[model samples]
Target: MTEPADIPSPERVLDAGALRALAHPLRVRMYDILSQFGPQTASSLAQLTGESSGATSYHLRALAKHDLIREVAGRGSARERWWERPRGSVSFTNPAVMKTPSGRAATQVIMSEFLNRRHQQLMRYVGDSIKTPEDLYDAAAVISSTTIRVTEEQARELAEQLTKVLSDASDRFRDQEGEGVVPFSLRVDLFPLPPESN
Candidate 1:
């Protein structure tokens, strides 16, 4: 569980070609899997994702082409190369990227694929969980929240705070190898908009 590095300034926009390269469902899935699991070989990823080895290998190459992921050196294994995510996370100005037809399509495809995967995971969790009051309460205890109205500077501060909290928790468990703790995901989202929009 390596800590994420310093949060950088938000890009006002992202390139159309790069986003287009990321638009495929398989590519986005590969990115998310690699980001969560760290470096892995294509064969390992294929088994984890339940996709054909050749298809996984192909999408891995495509993702590499767009600089979203990169091959990392492995220990003297010529048959098995490892890959990793380029960044901790990705962001872009939605409106700025949507001006061009291809850009808009690419944006829609990437977002839809990401959100659909999230929704499916949430649904699976809900479906498999016990419906009792005590069970729900236990689940609720794991969640936290805060609200604030802020300038851009404050928003950046909030982002840093959230990232630190998650990173610290990750550090705590990282050393306990083979403890068999269920891996949980941390999701952080920030939106600043006029009250009327809500």
Candidate 2:
């Protein structure tokens, strides 16, 4: 699936200011919505979020202050500005930021919101799988889980390998555009299970 730009390059880590700016629940949701759905006016986002346009507009300005989102060039008027997430990956792991109490709380909010959004999407897809077209279903749709034992170093290697594969594929197909083109979410989770309780 084509991201809005050339390649899914190195992730940009959020500084304390940006982290605090996005710590709000609504802001986090707005950020995710923009990443998934592309550009939108505050009015449009308000409708999708069930929030007042005034509120959405205010929060949008806050997000923009940290460069989390930017106004679409030459699009929309002063009364109706369009905004979109810049094309790139962003990492929430900031060691310096995490040392502060506020930063830790902000990270918790951000991660929780993101995970909830992803889970909602997955559930929706699973619920609608039966109604999905056979061709689309068979082509590139799957839900799978496998557990295996691995050393900590091995787990790190596996994560890197899988990331490289996905990034390569994303870079290769990022410029493809046509009638049938659409966005797709590619997810990969590689983590060790917790120890059994005594």
List, residue by residue over 14-52, the lDDT tens digit for candidate 2. 999999999888999999889877888999999999999
Candidate 1 residue-wise lDDT, 10-43, digit = tens = 2224567678878898888887777666677789
lDDT of 2 at 64: 98
* Best candidate (score: TM-score): 2
Question: What TM-scores do the predictions have?
Answer: 0.68, 0.88
Model 1 ranges with Cα > 4 A deviation: 1-14, 92-96, 131-182, 189-198
Give the alpha-carbon lDDT of every model.
0.70, 0.85
Per-model RMSD to reference? 5.1, 3.0
